[model samples]
Target: MLSTFILSQTKFDDVNELVKAGEFTKASKLIDEKVKTMNLLHEEIFQLQFEKERLERIRKDFNKTADDILKYARKYYPNATESDLRKWEDDGSLEYKIIDGKKWYFARAASNLFRINKEAKKQKELIDGFKKDPLDVFLESYTPKVLDESANAQEKLVKPVTFRLNYTVTVEPNAVPNGEVIRCWLPFPREGHERQQNIKLLGINSDEYVIASNDNLQRTIYFEKVAQKDQPTVFNIVLEVTNYSEVNFIEPTQIKPYNKNSGLYKTFTSERAPHIVFTDKIKNLSKEIVGEEKNPYLIAKKIFTWISTNIPWAGAREYSTIENISEYCLTRKHGDCGIKTLLFMTLCRYNGIPAKWQSGWMLHPGEVNLHDWCEIYLEGYGWVPVDQSFGMVDSEKEDEKYFFLGSIDPYHLIINDDYSTPIFPAKIFPRSETVDFQRGELEWRGGNLYFDKWDYHMEVEYIEPK
Candidate 1:
């Protein structure tokens, strides 16, 4: 699919405004009228259909009512008052929208409240006995080991850890009519990356499947299965990969100036619209945060530190719903992994730093989850990993605080070196995920089957080093 299209601009704008105003019914009608009367390009029609799909996706994300959120909050704060809820809402910690005069909360708003609000977290720990997340616990123990190993080793890469991963996507029973072909794109490990190597697909449940070529940035294993009545259609792949820890030892003095004419520098630093545009807000914020920093690494560090300190991580709405993720994150004052990473990339790019997206699964022992981070290119040092959402480490040593800035743990399962890139075999409809592809995507002759229509699960086993 084409990355962009030129629609009937003024009419499309009206539809967009209607969708934004929660006038989806009107928006749908207008879209149909345009298709019938306007000489629209196929791409424009495709875009319009997605605009309709966007409305449905938004409905799903913002399904909760005020009462629902309050009830959920009362789980930890049984005496939680309406005023407290209102306060959280004002702070943007509890995501909600005043849709057509009725307040609708993001589906994860109740769960994310504690994550974004410090007092709510304290209350939860006191009342619900909340503990540190397994992922945080694992990172505490694992990061230090990698840093120590990298500090001593002559080579930049250290502590190669191999894992056997089983990933499955199940389309809910009758998601489509029985015997209809369900097309699936499962997230498979990317090839030809130095840090991620020895990728071997052990097996797949389906007898026939096409593993996307190494060049597909968003690499996927495509499968086709017929839906069965009352039974979920399942697709899975078991694969073994050796993921290595990357520790690029850098010296401030040795950092080289970016070769301005280089294509890598040009492509990444320039604005990619809909998300990475260098808006006035971004330009000003970058100036405020960077503050006359000339060194490329230091400039990146400044942007990273500012986001780490200011933009607290919160659960994000679906990527497709938001027109501009980076700007949304800035306005909301919080975002999840990919949201923060997008903001990070935008700021870095605005400041002439070459930054791009990297994501997959972070398989840290028992703490496996869909994750996103980015890599920034330095002239002499090559590209370095930066997990902006992980934030700064609580340590006096600069290296410890900056470990993720230049290094990555072996727990990473690098699936996409970049975001919003093509899926091999070329999907016919808009992807279930317009941005990052982690959970996998499905569709049939009917159309795209969204996240609500299916479920995804990943299981991992550690292989002992020889």
Candidate 2:
């Protein structure tokens, strides 16, 4: 009887019946119960089997994409030594790419690849299934609740607008001087009009002084002057707009003012404490250098020094989230153009120097994009341009330290203000709190447009006095 029970539990019903034949009807009922139980067990086994198969298929697809990326990387970078590949893998510099059915990278494994692949595949299946379904489906998506969505309530809205920025700087005689340059890089516009071209050059102001426009990166204008003696000079620049299209104007625009209470402001204030380079260092270094609270030139020099020495410029252009530059300066100790400019602005504000934000596109022939920097307000000078990102100060150069401050190369054009209300107004869609300083976008109706969708052009004219 014990053996029969054991056999019955082991799924051997025939053996269980042979040991308990005298209770034939009871044995028959027991077999019926066992059969029902087996059916449930079979269903569970089939489900597990199906799951294993599905997972295996997903794994195979992911491995295939990874392999393809590897093969492409090897083919393209044949000269790359094995050590280079290993180092990239170790440092997590490599990633896999499968964008829009086109592969983007051929590199080592990326930790996110597995998850991305799974999610992408699932989305693809969902989209495909929706297409096949005869029933209509409603897809609900969400957008931010910001202003700017009501700009286009009517047709014949206002045309797009453009602005021109000019700056002048005066420096001490025999001060090592370097030329100033401008950079205009904007986010590529989605629609409207596109950038047509850029024109800039140089001329002779006098036998001792020459005016040259540094027009590389297309949109920046650098006004460079090399002075042999400590003397005063003036720089004139004009940015002209052509072929621009009009768009509706939106309001409630509040420019972000230079905030002394900001963390960035505190950092610069602490760094520029009494007896430091600007105050005591200047006193110790030269009798000619003097500290005056109202001296814009001296304040400008100090701001330049703090930016060039303290901030390390790097490219975090493709980041999905906006980083807190002040916090970054406090922590990682590095940043890109935006971060550096903020730091510069903060330092100036802490010391009662007035500074603001300016940004636009640096137009290349085939490419025009957005860039950012700052401007400082001086008592005698109004608002003077400062590009801390390019290390326009003398301290930024390794061999030639402290040469470029108060001067710039003539190669740039300004297209937009740093913190103005948007041209088209805000949309309900979520927009980046930190504007890219180049192009902004909005979508409501089925249509799309870019900076090129409108008729817009920029011209730079360099004037040198005879």
Candidate 3:
């Protein structure tokens, strides 16, 4: 039947004769079947055509140039191997780019790969229990302890603390078009239980000018160009806070840790945390540890351990704001030198230990920078300096990593006192004051807060610790 069907379907004369002799109708039926087969093939061709267009669109969307991919990969991986990058491309994990005759991978893809690597390392450390190096361990383990409030009860008994204030002003030549005569007013500390009233002009040099004031009023040393200059010239002015009386030891003024309530105090305290961390450790270790047998030296050792174990030293995002330290502790779980010191101070204050603030910028022949630590009042020993941020002693025994609390390096320039005092003579424009001592002003040329504004800066030096 199949042979007869084939013959009838053929278009040759012999085949036609066969079909006519046997069954032309069967041959016609076979021809109809072949036509149906052709129609089915046409449908397949249409489906393939649609698929081709769809694939083309997908290729366009996924396509990336070599240069683009390479640039992104370099930025993201920074140290990734070329082979690995190629494998990533093969795996369809990254896109490529070509720009300026260069090849690159997508930055996002590279970053993803790098993240995976870091996470792996972190996990390995977590699992291995390989003791982190002293420094690494110290950075991870430091926390500021709470101070004992009872110890500071004597703060009220001590004489009002006093400090000498000193400053130098630089007058620029040609600062004004003409030789302008300038009058300067110096800021005095503010009013409270303390009194700062006496004023004195020590001396003046091309770069050296000095003024002295009694009483704790926040004052601004004003300079008026009495004579205008054609060329910019510089002059130095100095002022001294020769008298800081300690009427009594004040308790932690704010409820927050390390007196975090005041914005200015918070900034100064946090800015100086690293140094405080070390000092706090020493203070803690030197204590009796509550239940342990009392050994002053042993206690000091424990304090050092506690400091190294608790506070993690890291740079702060912004040290200028008052709440910088507290906020940092809350989020990053770490802080710079200043904040650590404040934490230590707070802890000591809470535990009946007397701790106070101390800070200054390090000044070399050509550079000056800010630094802070603390001081504790000890019986008979008086106030001794403590720089916990520098770390513990016998530093060589534990490596540089463990040397942050209890001591300080020599590269510091001390500037301000432990507590914030207002600028003296009351700024021509009244300004808000803070414990960490930041001074800002708003003025009205007239008798109102809405006067035209002016600004000033004060730089202090410790010629000799009084």
Candidate 4:
């Protein structure tokens, strides 16, 4: 069960069983029956109510039918056949579920199939004419330059790019009563990092808004607005930040053994249940991959290389619905940026390497979107950026091939230093995004508003170096 489940009673255990077995209808019925009979605590009642919402979210993610998948796949593969679809499903390349005697593919399955399957991507490129991910193309040109600059300058951070962004969130009309107050928490740039600095708030839409302190692990800019009849509620913030590409040229000879008594090492290496647990599977895989490696940096490199080569990136479902994100990614054999990053962090922690989450947005030109990566601590080197999703690049040079293992590019907008941390002013309801906080959160006195109730957009203007 997901850590979100608040109740520990025996009946709640039964509900958990039903949910695990995909008996959502039965689970909902059981919840209703228990609610009518049991003297549940307020938190218990809230958890029970949310179980239904969780089921609804699952349905939304797994709503596409077999026919729909076929129609979508044919857009790329005109000769796509049912046999090919079944092969993909069997191999876990195309995720689907058997729901009530019918097949329901993941909403993003069609597009993800091309991403995870090499042959599918080849076919699509043949039809669409040699396509490449813009971000990868961008990296190919700048990675060598950033490494060279860092080496020559004798500095970790180099190649700074300042950006001006107008981030906006709009709630659909009549999402709540016209007179009701809506609370929103927009993603704010995290302060006090070597690579991400000079954060400036240029302007904001709301006259009265609370900007959380720099120390809030998952930071935000909170606002409250009264809904208007037949009009959408909107919140906006304009900010400027200078991001730098970090290239830590790690020398294995200078690396020191970790002090076991240190708090930072202990806290980050220890298990955090539900997400970063050191399960049997995780421990076994760590041993298989990390064999006799004693150097912390070397151990981390092995983990990063294994994951990048094994787990192909794919679109993921909402984080709130997942029980264990790392385990889920490991089981599915594919995941998005956040999913791969979690698995990487978990493996590093299991090997006694301190790893922590870092995410906000990727400010790549014409390709801005929410993204995730992590940081790992070395005794002598301190914490360095590691982007498992970016992984190993195709280059003969050591610096460029393992760029993300100990370094990162300049396009990051880090909004959260740690995962699953509380927002400032305290949210009355559970956050829509339990893990990462990039999209922004909204709620009313009535209840928390899920992603479907509103939309968010970011417009980035690169502040060219003067």
Candidate 5:
């Protein structure tokens, strides 16, 4: 009788049991209703909702078993083998879960592998006919002649461009309780950087918006709107910013080493958990990459070249959920811009070079998209930009080849000074994105809303040249 009582489980405990047994949908629905009844803190409620919702979504379209995934991979490419599938999944190039005692892979992951692997096999060259693989499509058309001919060192400063931006954030039709306040945060530019400045909020659709202090690393403009029963809650803002192109002429041999005791040196070299860290493998790899190089510039150059040549760009899993982003990239040999940036920073830091994270929008004439890059600190130069993703292994022109190593064009809409740092007015809930905050973060009293439950859109226009 005592054993029977011990074995008995509550309704909430049953949900946990179901989750452990890989019955995510059942578990999700079970605890979802009890969410309202549970006397939990706001953050606790938000995390519960977020986790359950994510589990259900992952189980929804990603129901294919191992055999099913293998079959799908073979369907697209006859050459695919069980070994290849296992390898990709382990490397995190493909993602999955264990459901009902079976290894299930996301349908999207299978499709990505099928499409990318198939095309990758056929390409000796990509984008166009070229002698070597061009670093980037934009780089192909760029030439040194574009620089201001009359500009000398004193006049080499970048002119700012007036960026007119229209940004929007919305929650799903019925994501939260009816009439509950949906708090939204939109990314806002800060006013500290020498290269990027003059941030002005020209207008906003929501009259009640709060701009965070200029010193906030991850600055945002907060807004609150009451969710309607069947309608989506939307927040919109319009702003203009001035951003200057960043460039630094380097004399590698004459450069001085940083004072090891300085705060800037100490802060950037120290490890930040989850993303930037020096694990055994990372430290070993850093040593291997650096070899005998004592010069920071040369060490940076070596690491940049190696990563660019090795890691081909691919769609990546969400950064918030990943444990160690730099290790993930280094081991996987494939990563998007942010992943590559983190890897570069980690390797640099491991070798006594200081580095930090930066992210914003890459405003090209054709498209505006989220992008990440890093800042490396040198003694005399202060902080210089380094974008391993914008590598120049293929470019023959010296100017075009080394352009992004320590400089950036004026097309950047700089957003976050540092990644993963908190924003103003402090969130009471676990953030939707725990790593890199770009699109925005949203939450209410009941729970935090994930990306699947919301949508965001951005538009950029050139108002004037500064």
Candidate 6:
């Protein structure tokens, strides 16, 4: 309503009228010129902020009816009952918001809990945890399908890949003011991130793009385009990166735990709130998982095994939407890569093991996925990769199972070592990805365009080994 009123006072209405008249190119050009001429005034900018704040206040004050909560829960867990959900809320496994003296929930919280949290309350057999019908897989696989024919074969299984890929982000036309300067931040690969190296900027489509400073925790190639009527604004980046297979063999005898007084140990070991905090439930679970274990390596192994056994891989809501991600996964029982990783990190940190976030994309010949995993800083052994969601499933390859616990194959394209860190040069509006920067962010002077208002496409082609 506020935006509708505000639109009445701006050139947007004129462009919109042109669009209705089938004068898109003219509307596009006219609005482009006007944006350069009349740029949004302070009052217009304030309205955008005001509207955003107003919506937030509504979100804060909204309360979910019992049926409302159950509605979301049943989508994920078909058999979930209101009583069962209330039991979760009663036990403090599910967190809720308060509005008008009633209990409410962030919808994602309700959904995540119904789907995954129930498992934390139940006990499962050891053999039931592994993935069924283990597929013969990637270079990341312990045994490769074409290891002998592959060039870059340093080990029995070799998977080396390079690619000149184009990633595109397009915002729905008319979502923002046509005259406003649309700003877009597309995900970019750092010069050398993990096994992904030789980052080269082949091109970007916009007239000017600022590849953020390399040190920015969540780096992006920022682009500015003048919004025009009737056509979606497009942003693109073409780049190349290569991944080499990585493996680590854990030798427990040589591991030395970190000193308690050191700052390095303190940083990762201590609790980080909103996601990685140690609640009573997490503390209790940590104690249970580490009942007789004193060694950091053994402690991590136990927690890793517990999570891999308990939490099965399932699609998850955006990290930004969840209040306590790790706890959500802990109580809900299933999560995607990121949710499981956060739960693993929080549990490890609670038990004096240091862990942190790492995510980007994973690529193999026919597959590419937006992925998240973690790195644990073990004494002497340094930082080791762990993917709890994809752990060793079958007992036959116990050594291979341990590979993901202490090491990761080199298929990772890590973009952020830390989650929720600010993008460089900063964004004037609230970030679309407040907790994690993966698909990237976009905004203009009037307001922000959310993921729903845009689409992101990632295309990859392997630079075959010579």
Give the candidate number with the greatest lDDT: 4
What is the C-alpha lDDT profile of model 3 across 1-466, one tens digit per residue?
1100001023335424433343433444444555556554643333333222222222333244554445555544455566766776554444443422345333344433322244423544555555645633433332111011212443312211223334443334433336444434433332221222223445344343323243433333433433355443333344343322122112222112323364443443332332233344434433434335333222333444555455555433223223234333423334556666665565454343456776654332233334566665433333444565555543344423332333222323333354444444333322222333322222223211110122334454434334
Per-residue lDDT over 163-275 for candidate 1, one digit per residue giving the tens place of the 0 to 100 score: 99988888889999988999999998998878889999998988999998888888899989999999999998999999898987778778998898989999999998778
Write down the lDDT of every candidate, Cα atoms only: 0.85, 0.37, 0.38, 0.87, 0.73, 0.68
- Specify the poorest-scoring 10-residue window by lDDT in model 5: 1-10
Tens digits of per-residue lDDT for model 4 on 105-167?
Answer: 889999999888888988888888986677788888889999889888998789899999999
lDDT tens string, model 5, 287-378? 78889999998898889888887776766676654557888887766788899999999888888889998888877666578888888988
Q: What is the lDDT of candidate 1?
A: 0.85
* CA deviation > 4 Å runs, candidate 5: 1-93, 106-119, 123-135, 143-154, 464-466
TM-score of 3: 0.38
Q: Quote each prediction's TM-score.
A: 0.95, 0.36, 0.38, 0.95, 0.82, 0.72
- Report the alpha-carbon TM-score of model 6 versus the true structure: 0.72
Scored by lDDT, model 4 comes in at 0.87
> Could you tell me the lDDT of residue 216 within candidate 3?
32
Model 4: CA > 4 A from native: 1-11, 76-83
lDDT of 2 by residue, 177-210 (tens): 3332211122222211232223222232323322
Q: What local lDDT score does residue 413 receive in model 3, on the 0 to 100 scale? A: 31
Backbone clashes in each candidate structure, one number apiece? 0, 68, 187, 0, 0, 8
Clashes of 2: 68
- Superposition-based RMSD of candidate 6 using all C-alpha atoms, in angstroms: 11.2
